[model samples]
Target: MRLIIGGGTLAGKPQLLFIHGIGSARTSDVELREWSTSLANGARAAGHADLVSGLTQSWAAETRFANYSDLFYRADAQGAADGISEEELPLLLALLEEMTQELGHQAELAGDRRSGDIIDSARAQIRAAVEPDAVQGQGLFAVVRRAGNAVTTLLQLPGLRQASQWTSGVQLLPVLSQVGRYLARKEPDDAGQGLDVRIRERVLSGLDPSRPLIVISHSLGTVVAYEALHMYTGRVPLWITLGSPLAMGALVLQRLAPRPPQTPAGVERWLNFWDRDDIVVARPRLERWMEANALGVVPVTARADTHGLWTHTATKYLAHKDVAGPVAETLKNL
Candidate 1:
């Protein structure tokens, strides 16, 4: 897959890097180019013609994509064609346990023992939820995906919706538990030993430290991007994260490399976008968590697909003026 997104050449011009999230290992280069073009189109349509020019102008064609999904696939030796590898099964289970324990602790602090009990009960049902399908020869990933989907569906039920005031992260934890596991997995020092390290390497491969760089990461990619920025020796003037789960205290924040900081080093501005209904990102506004860090948390209205999680789609975020406007403005200023 192509890593760079703008102009065929990469001699000069500021770099705009897009890092994608889960289930995107198979996204092709052609599709990424179209996304870049779509963002430009959306910006122009929203009356940001000047900002769009920064991307399209022949002399300074500047956008790139850091495609690191394959790194995860490779680390697990699970190609996109096949679902997830068997190795991830243990990691998934372990993470599920940890997530439940953490949630229980949070509930205990709030003196909501009932909610804690509910989480424990739900945790016990996870295996039952997947065993039938796994016994039928469905891949583990498929099983987990189905289980996650089921949680999303159940959350929307009228009765369930009114049961308790579950925060977004806790409510979505069942669906996102695996993601939390991958991010928290102990990483080896060697870049090749872990998916996170490999992803960072890919993002830094073509990074010209001298030029202006803006990073746009969505979903799990935001975690990878955050760690990469911490390690990279360069200047990233702006970091735009969409549908990010970074603010999910114990589940994500504590697991990050270098830990979650007030702001990543070298970042002058951090803008985060989230659709209030997007479950993956339990916390919509990051500035609250990353307090006084010059972070801007902007809200967007995204349709909750029947499937629910698809609301985090990058295409949808890119199509919005809220997202496009800042992108154009960032490029124009650069």
Candidate 2:
């Protein structure tokens, strides 16, 4: 019941729930969740249009983004940490489905189908894999998380990924999925609606009345996470935002601080993480709410992403040192 909603990899899992960031050419998280996870020679690419940047076709993009996972090798540390859980399973499956479909376009190159037919054939296979009572506990289910996504969800497909790079918009489609594309289409406020309700149902309802809850979020996802707190329940143990743009906007800060969540225990704890140069975090002049809530805070700046590091590794890695590690250590001392 604990909730972690933020840009894909920033959500860190085991119990971490990924909320992919903005992108174009959207697909459904439910549908994009099913790509071949064991990895293959010609595994497709990932990301929404924005994530892909300048790619034009799925084939070129797939070849460019060819990571080792596509070849089904051993996993990195974080990816092997945990299974994709029931809640996140659907979204991952949908992304995989979308990627596989994109890869299906290759069938046309191989002469298995026609141009338009490629999209159709891939979609059909994706649909078949997702059908209820399909191959349960196999294929995608074989691995907790496809090595790529697990890495991206927490790492945002860091630069280290080798083999092939995401070559085009079409290739990024699989990773970004329809959900990301859909978010791209919606106004920030509009997208916040569904997330708000989900927060109440998943986050607010799931926490113990007596114990405080930890809410970890990042980037644009931080906006809704705070919105949910302001509009929904008032009980939280800690609210951590990594690569958060909210810290730079005082209006946003003041709005969130007024009536924090109400846990049975006492007041809440909010640990805000920021990368100073990050455009998302903005400047010191923008922070408005700190003076309002004014709790005992530990403010420290780590490395800067300089014009927004699309990847959020700094936030996660530091939080391990400053956020989670501290929290666990503090809990231990208590």
For all predicted structures, in order, the TM-scores are 0.66, 0.36
After TM-score superposition, what is the CA distance of residue 182 in candidate 2 from its true location, in Å? 11
**TM-score, candidate number 1:** 0.66
Q: Total backbone clashes of model 2?
A: 40
Candidate 2 structure lDDT: 0.35
| Model 2 lDDT-worst window of ten | 63-72
Candidate 1: RMSD over Cα atoms? 8.6
Residue 253 in candidate 1, Cα distance off native in Å: 0.8
What is the number of residue pairs that collide in model 1?
A: 1
Backbone clashes, each candidate: 1, 40
Kindly report which residue stretches of model 1 are placed more than 4 angstroms away from their true locations once superposed: 1-12, 50-61, 74-149, 152-178, 185-192, 291-309
Cα misplacement distance, residue 198 of candidate 1 (Å): 0.8
